[model samples]
Target chain A: MIDFIFHFTMIAAMIIFGLIAIEHKNLIYSAISLAVMSVFLGIIYFILNAPYVAVFQLVIYAGAVTVLFLAAISLVTKAKGEEED
Target chain B: MLPLNLLWWYLGAAAALYVIGLYALVSTRNMIKTVIAIEILIDGAHLNFIAFAATPTAGIDPIAHSIVITSIIIGGCIAAIALSLAINAYKHYGTIDIKKLRRLRE
Candidate 1:
């Protein structure tokens, strides 16, 4: 019974976060939401008995990837102001 | 007294999420949204692999877990490349919308 509940909860969290990541209009907000979603997914992976994946998801995704995205966003925004004709 | 048939239920749900992710990838025009949809699709694939790994099959499939890890890294690389391209497009054309980007095809 507990396993079933955990499974359902993880699915629900994934769906909710996936939707939120795409539905937001602001790109930065969407990226932040994606980071939050990734963290939640890591927790779910731990619950599912995949501790290595959970750790990888947290470190690679929430840590490295999210920072990379933010850097890209900042670079783009800076370039946007310079390109105006 | 718990239903063993619930395994099928989880599989079906994972499939449904995969389809939804595919639809989002197909229908979105924004580059960021497309990337996020791809992530969703990858997540669905991982779920399926993990689900099968949990089952009592002929043998243990550690390969699936390894594949999922490899795919996640690949997906991150793809996302980075895609975002960089999108940034370049925005810089050159001043927009990230795919519909607007078609003007450059001439």
Candidate 2:
């Protein structure tokens, strides 16, 4: 029961954040949401007993990839002189 | 015990994510949003792969782990490259909206 609840919660959180990441009007907000989703997924990976995979996901997705998205957004955010998202 | 609802839960999540990602891809006009949608789609596929590879008696599959790792690497590279291209597009077009880039598309 605990395992099922844990997985179910994490998956639901991931899906919710993922939708916000893609559908949100603000780019920076979307990027942050993506990071949140990735972290939730990493927890799910850990729960699934793929500890190495979970670690890699946290290092890669939440760490490196989110940094990449933020960098690109910072560059482009000012390109148009529009309000920061 | 584990085979009963666990399998369907993962499977259902995979399906829902895939559909949501596809919908985002079709509905979104921003290049960045499209890229995010693609990431979500890949994640959905990864979930399906992991779910199917996991067995109640045997445990998680090593092969699936390897594959998911590679996929994660590739997805990161693809997202980085695509974001750069979007940046360049924004520089030229002043917007990342796909509909405005008619010359490049045709």
Candidate 3:
């Protein structure tokens, strides 16, 4: 029963995060949402008995990837005078 | 004991995610949003592989996990490259909108 609940929650959270990440008007907000989504996905991986993948998801995606994206956005934002897209 | 039938539920969810990702990719004009939609599509594929690996009949396929990992890395690399190109396009064209990027085609 616990496993079932965890599975459903993970799926729901993944879907919600994906939507928010793609649909948000602001790129920063979308990037933040993607990071949050990666953290949740890490938790889901743990629930699914893949602790290695869970840690990788957290470190590589939530940590490195998010930082990379933020850096890219900053560079682009600085180069372009206008911010709204 | 959990019935194997429960796997179908996960499969359905993965399918739904794929559909949503496809819709976003088709409808969104923003380069970043399209990139994100691609990520979501990749996530759906990863979920399917992982769920299948968890099934008792599948015997926890390490091969599938390895493939998924490789694809994830490649997907990230592709996104990074695409974003850089989009930034360059913005620099040249002064706009990231797909409609405004028709100079190369003509």
Give the chain B TM-score for each candidate: 0.86, 0.89, 0.90
RMSD of each: 3.8, 2.4, 2.5
For residue B51, give model 2's deviation from the true position in Å: 1.4
lDDT of 3 by residue, A1-85 (tens): 8877877888788778878887787888888888887787777666655667677667777777777777766655644456454
Q: Could you tell me every candidate's TM-score relative to the true structure?
A: 0.84, 0.90, 0.87
lDDT of 3 by residue, B1-106 (tens): 2247867877876786788789888877777767767767877787787778767787677787777777777767877887888778768876676755775558
Give the poorly placed runs of model 3, Cα more than 4 Å off: A78-85, B1-3
CAPRI quality level assigned to candidate 1 from its DockQ score: acceptable
lDDT-based ranking = 2, 3, 1
Please report the candidate that would top DockQ against the real structure: 2
Candidate scoring better on lDDT of 1 and 2: 2
Between candidates 2 and 3, which one is better according to lDDT? 2
Docking outcome class, model 3:
acceptable
Which fraction of the native contacts appears in each prediction?
0.28, 0.51, 0.21
DockQ of each: 0.35, 0.54, 0.44
**DockQ, 0 to 1 scale, candidate 3:** 0.44
Which clashing pairs does model 3 show?
none
Question: First chain of model 3: TM-score?
Answer: 0.85
